[model samples]
Target: MTVKKILGAAAGALGLMWVVRAAWGIPSAIGASMSAIQPYASGAVSYRDRHFHNTEPGSQIVAGSARSLLYSALTRRNAGHPRGVIPLQTPVVPTEAADLAVTWYGHASALIEVDGYRILADPVWSDRVSPSAIIGPTRMHPVPSPLSDLPPVDAVIISHDHYDHLDKATIRSLVAAQTAPFLVPIGIGAHLRHWGVPEHRIVELDWGGSVSLAALGRTREGTDLVLTCTEARHFSGRGLVRNTTLWASWSIVGATRRAYFGGDTGYTKAFAEAGTALGPFDLTLLPIGAYDERWADVHMNPEEAVRAHADLCVGDPGHGLLVPIHWATFNLAFHGWSEPVHRMVEAARAAGTAVAVPVPGQRVDPNGLSPRDSWWEDVG
Candidate 1:
C-alpha cells in the first residue's frame, strides 16, 4: 500500500478507537440523573431547588470561578506519586469481632469491626476509580483482599456517590459476594438501582436518618449495628450535574462500641453537632488526603482531620483511635503522596490525639492499639 493509504487507515482506526472508548464510559459516567433521584432528593431537608446544599455558607467550591478551576487543573504543585511500592497486609477472616477494630484496605475502603459485628465502609476494590476503565486514577497498590475474600459483613456503608467512594464495579461485586444491605446516603440508591442492585437490599437515608441492624441483619442474632447517615461538607455528581445525591459522614454504633466514618468532608461545625448528639466514639476514620487550596472547603486537610477527630470524639482528643483514609491509593490532589499522614501525625501529637496509621489491609484494634511505625516514610 502507498504511504498515504496507510496513514488514512491508521487515522480511521484511531478515530474508531476513541469513539468506542467514549461510548463504553458514557453509561457509568452519566449515572443516575436528577429525574431518577428527584423523589428521594426532594424529601431530604438539605435538598433545595432540585439539588442538595451544604448547610455551611461561603464554601470555596461554590465561590470558585471557572478560570480559577482551570488554573488549578493546569498546575502540578506536588509530586503526588509514591517513590516505592506501598506495603500491604494479608487480611484474615476474624472468627469473632473485637470491641472496636478497623482494617484499612487503602483509600476509603475499610472494615470496621465493632461489638462482634462488621461494617465495611466505602469498599472500592477496582483497579481504577473512573467512569472509563482505560483512564482516570489508577490504584497505587494491589487490593489487599479480593471481594470473594471478604467475610460476611452486617452492613456496607457508603458515604457518597463520588467515583472514588461509591464505585459501581465494587458495588456489583459486593451485591454477589455478601448478603449485607447497602446503607447509603439519600439518592445514592438511585445509582445502585440503575446498576441492578436489588431494591430490598438498599437502605437509603437523608442526613440524620438511620438503620438498625435488627432490621437489616441477615443473622438470627440480629446484630446491634446502628448506621446513621450524618452531614458532610462535600458535593456529589457522577456526570456534569452535581449534588443530585447527598454526601455524608456516618455514625456506626454497635452495642458496646461506636465509630465515626468521615467518608469525605471539609472542616464543618456539623462535626461538633454529631459529637454532641451521637458520639464519644471508640474509633473515627476521617479523610486526610486529596485536599487542594482550590477546593479546600470541600476536602479536609490532615490538620483539619485531626481537628474534626477532636470535635467528634467530644474534645477528648486522646479518646478515640483516628485512622486516616482517602489517601495513599489515588492521586486526587497536588500534595506529596505521604504528606497527609505525616501532617496528621504532627497535628495529632499537638492536639493530644491518638492515631493509628494502618498499612493497607492491616487491622487495628483500638482497645490495644499498636504504636505507629511511620511506615510510609520509607515508601514515600
Candidate 2:
C-alpha cells in the first residue's frame, strides 16, 4: 500500500476508536453549557425530540445513504491557504469601543465587543475539529490570534455541541487561559462539565432564555451584558444520539448595541423572528458558508443571509452593516475556498445590502468601517 493510504487508514481507525469512546460514554454530547439544567427561556422548547439526532440516522450522516462522506469526498476541498490574504495597511483592531466590534478568528470563532464587554463565541484555536487528533476536518489555516493574545473577555458563548464548534482541547485551553464564564444553550453544559469546566463558570440557558452578566468594564454605570439563547433550525450531536441536547444562535445585547451570533444553522423563519423580538440589531453576524442544495433548510446561502438581515429590521437592510462569517477559517465543506465569500459579496450587492468582508483575523467595526479589497478571489 502507498505510504499515504496506510497512514490514512491507521489514523481513521484510531479516530473511530476515540469517537466510539466519546459516544459510548456520553451517548449524546448535547445539552446545557453549565453543569445544571435550566428551563426553556421562551416558555417552551422550539425543537422536537427526535431519535435520528441521537444515533446514526439510518446508518449514515445523510440518512439512508453515505451522502455526507460521498459529497465531502467529491468536493475539491482544501484548507485555509495562504493565497488570499489582504495585507494590512495600518493593522486595525475591530474592537473600537469596549463594545460594538468583532474579530473573526476563523470559521465561527469570533471575539465580539458590545456596549463595553468582550464576548468570545465558538473560539476554536485547536489545530483540528475532530474527536481524534489525526482525523476529521483539520483547520486550513492557523488561528489568526493565539489563545493567549485574547483580551480579558467577560463571557464565552458556545452555540452547540458539534465537534467542529464544540472542540475539547480548545475548550480546555480557553478554560485555562480566559477567566470568562461559559454561556451555553440547554444540555451543552453537560459536555462542558464532563470536560472539567468549573460549575460556577457555567451558565446554562434554553432558547429565548436570557442571563445578565454585570460589572463588565462598567461603561453604562448600571447595566450588565445580557445573553439570550435563540432558536436555529439545525440538528446537533457528537455521537450516536443527536439533538438530545440543543443547538442555538445567541443575541448579545450590551449596554447600548446588540448583535447576533449565528452559530451553525440552516435557513429558517427564526432569523426574522429573532430580529423582530431582539433586533433591529446594530450588526448581524450571519453564516454564508458550508451550504449545499441538499441541506438548504439547515444553512443559509449568501442570498438568504441578506434577506434575513432585511427581515430583521425596519430600515434599509444595510442600516446595520452585515458582516459575513462561518467561512474562510477552515475547510469544513467543499466549494472553492473563497467561493462562499465571493458569492456572498455578489449576493449582498444584488440585494443592495451592505457587507464588510474582512480578511480572516482582521477585526471590523461595522459602524465606522474601512474599505476591504476582495482577497479570496485567488483561491480556486
Candidate 3:
C-alpha cells in the first residue's frame, strides 16, 4: 500500500475509536476528579480505612453474580420499562413558599418548600444516569423544567456521589444557573470543584453536622433555616470504587415546619435516632423504587420505606405526609415498572400512613394533600 493510504487509514481508525468511546461512557477514573477529598472525607466520624462506613452492622451492598445480573436483564425485559408514555407535568414555581410543600421531578429529584425557603434535593436532570449519554438508565419522561428555569433556591442538597444522584452535567448547569450553595455529603465537593463550581458555594457536611442558611437571609417570620446532615444506610461512589464519600439523609428545619429528605437508603436503626434528634417532621420524602432482594441491604423496598417513614416520624408514620420519590423516571430494578408505587400505596394504606404519590413535576402541599390517585396505573 502507498504511504499516503496507510496514513489516511490510521487517521480514520483513530477517529472511529473516538466516536465509539464518546458513545460509550468516559471511564469514571478518567472523567471524575479525586483531589482534595481526603480532608473532607476523613473529617467525618464514620470515615475509616479510606471510606465512609454505614452505621448498620453486618450490612453489605452485594453486587450479586454477573451471570445472575445478565439473566435478570435479559429475562425481565418487559418488566423494566413503562407500559405507556408516562405523563409529564410542567412544574409550577409557587409565588411564595408554602408551610411545607414538595415538587417531585422524578427519581429522587424534588424541591422542598418550608418556612418561605426552597431546597432542591438530588437534582439529576440528565437523560441518562451515567457518565455517558448513550448508555445507562435513561429517563422515562422528560425533565419537568429545564435547569435554567428553576427558581432561585436557598440550597441544593446532594445525598451521595452515585451517577443517578449526582450527574456532572446537571451539576455544571446548576452551578451556572443558581447562586445557592451545594450542601453535599463529605468528599462530594471534589466533584463539584471539578465541575467548576465555586469553592464558596460548596458546603460539605458529615453525619450529625449542621449548617444554617442565614446567608440567604431570614424568612418572612424572621427565622433562620438550618440543614442537618443525618445518617442513611447506603453506599456511595460514581465509579468502580465505592464508599469514598459519605451518603446521608438531610433534615431541613424551618421555623414552624421541618422536612426530611431520605436521599436513598435501606431500612436502618438510624431512622429512629434521626426522629428522636429531628422528629415530627411536617413532610418526609423517601425512596420507594429500584429495590431488589439482592440489594435489600442498600436499598429499601416500598414496605420498608413506609416503616422508615414511621421511624423518622417518631413511631407515627401518619404524623407527617409521606411523599414517595425515586421511582417512575428510570428503570433501575427487576420489578415491573409500576410495582413500587402499587406496593407503596398498598402498604401505606395498610399501615395507615398518610402517603401521597405525586405525578412527575406535580407540586403538592402537605397540609391539604389530596387523596391518593394511581396516575401511574395506566402508564405502567
- Against the true structure, what is each candidate's TM-score? 0.95, 0.81, 0.92
Worst 10 residues of 2 by lDDT: 51-60
For residues 182-222, what per-residue lDDT tens digits would candidate 2 score against the true structure? 99877777778777899888887877888888633323456
- Model 3, range 3-70, lDDT digits (tens) per residue? 99999999999999878976664654223444467766766899888888887754553555667767
Report the C-alpha lDDT of model 1 over 1-380, residue by residue, as the tens digit. 99999999999999999879856956865578788999877768898899899999546464636676666568853468899999998986678877789898999999998888889999898888888868788989999978898888888999988889988888998998888899999899999999889999999998899878887645436557778999999988888788889999999887788899999899899998999889988789999999877688899999999999989988888887899999999988878999999999999999999899989989998677564899899999
Q: Candidate 2 at 185: error in angstroms?
A: 0.7
Cα lDDT for residue 171, model 2?
85
Question: RMSDs, each prediction?
Answer: 1.9, 5.9, 3.1
Please list the C-alpha lDDT of all candidates, in the order they appear: 0.87, 0.71, 0.85
Task: Arrange candidates, best lDDT first.
Answer: 1, 3, 2
TM-score, candidate number 1: 0.95
Provide the lowest-lDDT 10-residue window in model 1.
215-224
For model 2, the superposed segments whose C-alpha errors exceed 4 Å read: 1-44, 47-72, 75-97, 215-220
Residue 346, candidate 2: Cα error in Å is 1.3
